[model samples]
Target: MGWFGDDSDEAEAYKQVMQRPQELSRWSNQLLGDAAAYEAGKAYEDHVAANGHPDEHHQAKEILAGVIGDFVDREVEVQGLDFIDRDWAKRHAQRRAEIELYDQHGDRW
Candidate 1:
């Protein structure tokens, strides 16, 4: 069984993809254990939004990956570039509010 469109591999592929329900359920339960964790905090989001520019995290990741520089050395390496000209915080908050409402109303979010 291999990944070369072999019929013999179909069962393996099926099992691989379908085998994660238990793990997914366990992970979901663990994640949802604290209801507040899913509650995205505004101050935290704002902080990330503010400090996420010029992506120090990305730079660190690239540095770890052995890209030698204080930053990623490429034109395509722009970070924290948001195309939307509006305050994403409000939009994000609204989406979260909807999800929270769904969760509160006994519907899965």
Candidate 2:
């Protein structure tokens, strides 16, 4: 758990590595919930405004998450934080986007 490992396995000598989800957080900080998050939320809100809210808010959240996730991956690499897990970063970005959407739009979306 302390040391990190991808989804790989082999002989027992190396010891079975534990996949820690929490540790997957390489960018689950304000770096996500900050400016980029605002933009992502705004974009999703605009989408909802134009197309109307999805039948399920989770769908909108998923849309926001995907956009933020892409942004996170590109920005992390651009900022030279390649050690972070892209998927993990994306998941965190999604969470922030969902919160932002809720704060901005409330139950309307």
Q: Best-fitting candidate, measured by TM-score? A: 2
Tens digits of per-residue lDDT for model 1 on 59-104?
3222222221211122012322132222232343334433433343
Q: Which stretches of candidate 2 lie over 4 Å from their true place?
A: 1-29, 83-88
What's the lDDT of the predicted structure labeled candidate 2? 0.52
What C-alpha lDDT do the candidate models reach, one value each?
Answer: 0.28, 0.52
Candidate 1 RMSD to the real structure: 19.1
Instruction: Give the lDDT of residue 25 in candidate 2.
Output: 47
In the predicted model 2, the residue pairs found to clash are: none
Worst 10 residues of 2 by lDDT: 9-18
TM-score of 2: 0.55
Candidate 1 local accuracy as lDDT? 0.28
